[model samples]
Target: MPGSITGTIVDPTGATVAGARVRISHRDQSAEQEALSGDDGQYSLPNVTPGPFQLTITLVGFTTQASSGILRSGENYTVPQIAMPLATAVTEVRVVPSRVEVAEDQIKAQEKQRVLGVVPNFYVSYDHHAVPLAPKQKFELAWKTTVDPVSFGVTGAIAGIQQAQNDFSGYGQGAQGYGKRFGASYANFLASTYIGGAILPSLLKQDPRYFYKGAGSKRSRVLYAIANSVICKGDNGHWQANYSSILGSLAAGGISNLYYPAKNRDGAELTFENTLIGISESAAVNLLQEFFIRKLTRNIPNYEPVSP
Candidate 1:
């Protein structure tokens, strides 16, 4: 059972083709052949030893073409040009977005984590590339902290402590005295935070948050925490002189003179002294944040794991 077999291949448009795989087979025995079509879509398997056979042609990105035929000894079988159909499309698409939009959404979610369910903890950003907040966002955070119920509770507690200690004696011992002290303390809180955390930070391009640098050696982390009292991250993410914290400290101290008992008022020298004290206090608090507060904070999200 031997004969010759031949075939050609074409595209759906029925034009001459090349670079196609042509295969032939019979039961239990087979001969494989391949040829590129001439420009006229002509091909042949001349003198091909044959029996009943199958032919398949294929090309990239096109449906394969196939046919069946029979051949007897010394016969030439020519298959019509096999036309291939187009393959289905494989579509791929991708999407990307601006970084600022992602950061803004993060900020919105962080605005909700209040300590004791009341004190605003809006300043921290877990994201390393947290876009520098706009001036509006700074003030908005300040406003949120000021209006929180815990702020009033803390103010009342401070006023009570001052009354018990009789610290502002000029405010006298009574409801009116307590009122004066409360107002003064509340005013102090407002001025310091708005000036340091919002207004001046916006003007000076300083970030007021204690950036948690939870990595590196303990000594380096300690130094970074302390240095932050006098240095701050700028919108550009570089360390810069912390004019906002310094000036806000001084401004808060200066404003205190206006509301305290006249005898308790600090002169300019005392104001500068108090400002230094405030800076020291900030360093201590930053160190605490670096080491302790994260443990105490109940609802903060995205906290990095601290090694034991």
Candidate 2:
């Protein structure tokens, strides 16, 4: 005898789920019966053989469901309403800043850095893995250092001391002499800063900032600081000889000869001596930065220390 099977499909929220696929199969029968739930979420299979039957319901974006029951002879069997749960889905998203943008942010932090909350300490990066700066950013840093009020104050102090000692006697002592010394001192600062920290670094694709290595043995750190005077990290992040700083010192020293009193200028010999002195000064400053300056620097970002 043939019977019929009918059913309704719904979602977990108890709303009717139309267009769901409903299928019925009998163990004794080789053929399977299938129907799609209509707009009313109802499905029917008529003239099905009387036997134990299995019902399966499936819909897109929902889990498949199944039920089984026996059908009597010539009986119209109504299946209990089926509720399908939504399929689980996992999605991952990641947001990363561009290299230029990251470098800009780091520069902002560096600009805020000052030793003892007074002097600019903008050339040191606490973040060891910092992104390389673009040429514009290098120039910007140099300009900032040049125009800083503290820089002017420091230069004026040097001029005052030079006048007291009459070191450049060719200028003579007086307000006029003090003015000449101040202008000459500031010119040296400007020339060296732009030539070494900005122009040369940009041209050579080198990073001008010192990267602080906060993790290591004291001996290793000391060696690292001293080595930095002759070597630096390239834009590609590899260590290389620091031609920019070395050449910049020589260039600035050569330029000074143009303004310095003839007797004070020693030509190539003086330039080489100044360059060597500059290298020694850099090594000493690096040592101070590695061991003491960081403790006194204000507004430093709390970046993670590099691994040893």
Best by TM-score: 2
- Candidate 2 — which residues are off by over 4 angstroms? 1-96
Q: Which pairs of residues collide in candidate 1?
A: none
In TM-score terms, candidate 2 sits at 0.69
Candidate 2: C-alpha RMSD to true structure equals 21.6
What's each prediction's clash count?
A: 0, 0
Q: Write the per-residue lDDT of candidate 2 for residues 77-127, one digit (tens) a residue.
A: 999999988977743233435567778998999999999999999999987
lDDT tens per residue, model 1, 1-308: 34566767778787767777776654324457666666666667766654446676767877766677656446778886688777777542324333345446666767776656556667655443344676777787788878878889999999999999998798998999999999999999999989999999888877776667776688987998899899988876668999998999889889888889898888999888888988899889888777776566656667442211
Q: What TM-score, computed on C-alpha atoms, does each candidate reach?
A: 0.65, 0.69
- Write down the lDDT of every candidate, Cα atoms only: 0.74, 0.87
> Candidate 1 versus the native: TM-score?
0.65
